[model samples]
Target: MTIRYDLPLWRPPSEGSSLIIQSTIGCSYNHCSFCSMYTNKVFRIRPLEHIFSDIDAGARDWPQAHRVFLADGDAMSLQTESLHRILDYLHARLPRLARVSSYATPDNINRKSVKALASLKARKLSLIYLGIESGHIEILKRIAKGASPRGIARAIQRASEAGFQVSCMVILGLGGREYSERHIAATVELVNAAPPTYLSTLQLDLHRAAAPGFVPRWERHGRPFQSLNDDECLGEMARLVAGVAPARPIIFRSNHASNALSLGGILPRDKEAILRTIAQARNAADSWLRPRSLRGY
Candidate 1:
């Protein structure tokens, strides 16, 4: 039996090939001003009966599958028991399943206790892809992120303590030109405190859907949003890399398709090199950066 996917499927870049199961529809908090990914749909958790049928279909067709990504924004929003049951069913049916992962919001992570997180981790839900966006409280507020720097750090710390490997992401140009420095400093502080297993950066792209909601907010604040140019964006990236001093080694990447310059290395050890690469990108001709037309969410 062929399983049909819900429209507008999304997964982390690394999970491109993993089987994606939509445990939730849309994003529970779809109000982030910078995000347009889920603006077209309403948020709802998939029924267990439907979810189970999808899993059965996947197991029948892809018995050798090892990685599974629960989808549609934040699947971790599901109740602890519901998530565990899904994980249990996936592992039981696939037999070769090694990990079950999902995109998680800070709110969702905070909703569960460390004990609940530990239980999920024990059941093969080993990783969470968290979009930290920006750590500056003001920037978060401006973007309607509904997350604070301290709250984000504590949530990551709790997940880490629960033995969940976290891959956290920050938007490089989220604060635009005005708030760049504070954004970098606060984000570095947060990362240093929580220290994710993997850290990735994506340059901000103002998709058409997001612009309608985002622009007015900037206008209402009496501070016009000044987007960073290619050079300015690279400069912000350089400062961010240089400022981060994590307690543990973190695999870092700025190689997302949205990024003007591709960069990857372990933190601190490769810090100088990453900075130098950003410098080179800054010095390169305007044509060298990823073309604006080519960039997408």
Candidate 2:
């Protein structure tokens, strides 16, 4: 039996190896200005029977699949009971099922109580990927992120307390050149306040062709978007590395295809090394950065 995935399925870079089951058709909140991921499809939860069919097919083919990432966009936005049913079925079919993860937003986490989260964690749905694009309120509003920095921190901490592995993502140069300082400073503050288990960075590359409204939405605030060049982007990354003082160790990465330079290590431990590399990249950009033609969103 073949599983039919909707066109343009998206998963976190880390979930590249997992069995992907489409719990939903598109993003529940498709209003973010910078995202064109789900603009083609309207949001709707897949029927339970349809989802179960894909699960059974996946198990039949990959009987020992240990991890599954529910797609598309925010599967965590589904109701608590709905998630429980899916998790129950997944364990029933895949004896080696060790983890279940999905993309999530602050609103999704906030809507679920600690008890609900703990219950889900018990069922092995224990990881969540969040896009805290920028912590600066002005930048957030300008990008139509719909969540505040403090609120994001609360959601991250809440999930952590309930025994979930939280992966947070920050978009480098999201505020472009104008708000670079504010963006990096606020992001550092948020991460320090509520550090996630994994922290990653993806440089901003507005898919104007995919998102026809990106420019209009971004220009809504009457500010001209001045995107940071390769060196400038590296500088923002350096400032972020220098400013972060997490309460605990955090796994950091900047190897997304969009990043100019790839870097990964545990924070506070490899902080200096990462910063020095960023400095080197800034100084010796031609050698350090990926060729401009090699990068993708």
Candidate 3:
């Protein structure tokens, strides 16, 4: 192999076919209660020379590649100046490179100036995968997400203003059973106010590694977290699809492995059909939903 990736690397499902480059190691803010994706490593930016070597190798392997996904966690944590240099190197190495994307934390996006973001966008860092997680302020704190509803919305809006497409993910059962209704309501309001170009849903499936901290953190809110059943998870997803009436259309997806159902369509456009499928899945045994044993995060 021309390029060797750090083990346990991850990227959005859509980026599976793109060349993978480790621009950073782990997440900058590793305190999110419901996440274990980066618990195994400390966060740090890759040296520019190492990143350049990876790009050069990738070009030799797949010169015609048009898209690349920066990994291992939020590559956006790199300084604006560092990112500009990385983007410049990527294009110079891969003549066909058309887009470069990475997971981004809301804080990181908000930290950079709009002019910096716009410059990055112009250089083909055209999209970011943001995990809004949940838009409810209480949930945000309980999870130690390091971001509030307002802050996440501001990040999304700022990215749009910079002409960058944002792909945001919201967890389906972040609030569990007790706060399900409130979670969905708050999330709906936030998305309607600051819509993203794409939105994806992830059902709550706490990893054994993440569950230790995830449960305790939420209980600190004065209530024990109760896991949601498949039926309830579907209900929350249905409400999200039904309520996502954005001024501009949002491309919605629930294809994450954790979700019981895999759905895709444009909100406020294919809303009815999306809801109808969920409605029909009232029976857990319905062929419409993935079986319990098959579900994963």
TM-score of each: 0.95, 0.97, 0.95
lDDT of 2: 0.90
lDDT of candidate 1 over 62-145, digit per residue (tens): 999999999989999999999989998998899989999999999999989999999999998999999888889999998888
TM-score of 1: 0.95
Candidate number that wins on lDDT, 1 or 2: 2
Stronger candidate by lDDT (2 vs 3) = 2
- List the candidates ranked by lDDT, beginning with the highest: 2, 3, 1
Residue 56 miss distance in model 1 (angstroms): 1.1
lDDT tens digits, residue span 1-297, model 2:
777799898888898899999999999998888888999999999999999999999999999999999999999999999999999999999999999999999999999999999999999999999998888998888878889998899999999999999999998889888889999999999999999999999888765324764564656667678877778788888888888888899999997888889999999899999998888778885898888688876
The candidate maximizing TM-score is 2
lDDT of 3 at 191: 98
